[model samples]
Target: MVDRPIIFSAAMVRALLAGRKTQTRRLATSPLRRVEVGDRLYVRESMHLWSAGHDAEVTFAADDRSFQTGPNTGDIPDASLTAYFRMVDQSRAKGRRISRPSIHMPRWASRLTLIVEGVKVEPLQSITSRDAISEGIERAGGEWRCYDSSGTGCLGARESFCTLWSSLHEAPGQRWQDNPNVVALSFRVEHGNIDTLYPNLRSARA
Candidate 1:
């Protein structure tokens, strides 16, 4: 599995989003839809802010997944791709369907698990769990306690890996709603699978 970075200028990101077929009108609290690089269109979340300064958000329809044409380095006007070693679900919107993106990958490449570390999260299975999210908490050296909800098809199933990130010693209250940082997790899946799952974090330079 090769690892690389996919960097997007603020402007190019908007052009990509503008090309998407789904109307970018709604700002519902949902995970940003996955957009394929070089294939699908994309728009940055920051571009949608009005006077109230809504949260930065972007969305791509599942249809764009098949259009992924790989990463870009020369400022391609079309949607560009970034090869990465990890992918994180930054759109922590609760109650949305968590389906796989439509990228052009083999069947074996579809199976992946994200190991988020260095934060606190609560398992979405707690009574306070939300319908849209399989929540988890990140705490103490990448350790996470996740809540597996019925939507995840892992509710009460110990084999499930659904979890949410939370703060240390904050108890199991609904405090995650106040977190401002984008949701990020550590990577430990198959080498090739890492970037596909979290291109943003994997491409980010330290």
Candidate 2:
């Protein structure tokens, strides 16, 4: 199985962590089109880091929970820890917290991995109610709603998914109305660092 990095917004990260999300749809870009079942995706989410000497701690922006990273405390390797310390030092020198974009997160810092179970290509607007639910829509009081929404009007699953799509893809040709082709990926979440869970993959890469 191939291992790759995938970036997710903080909201989506929370959904994945909560077991509410099982599917994600991305524009049919070349990279996404290459993904296949059995491939592993290590999630990259917004995070902050703090360090004391060689020991460091990571605070995920999604839940704002800190976890120690080191040989004794976690699976993070020494090389990765050293790289994180450099980032921490640079941030402190600039008088700011060590926060970086999700895309910049290293694989060692990732706490969530997704194992692709299925893949398909379809129009963005073709998402069904069941698929929308799998995308992390919430059902409350007999109403399906987006997780970030208040569910005030109590929309259906498909409608809630539309709202979410609009929020994330507002650019021209990327909106829900655009009906752009998308790569739909269905996956199961694994709650651990990719390298830790798949040590053989790490060795192969090295």
lDDT of 1 by residue, 57-173 (tens): 222332223222212322112212221111112222332322323332212222222232222222333323221222222122333223334333333312222232232213434
Model 2 segments beyond 4 Å from truth?
71-74, 78-82, 88-96, 146-151, 203-206
lDDT on C-alpha atoms for all candidate structures: 0.25, 0.81
What's the C-alpha lDDT at position 59 in model 2?
91
> TM-score of each candidate?
0.17, 0.87
lDDT of 2 by residue, 102-144 (tens): 9998777899999999999999999998999899876667776
- Candidate 2 yields a Cα-based lDDT of 0.81
Which stretches in model 1 have alpha-carbon errors above 4 Å? 1-61, 64-120, 127-206
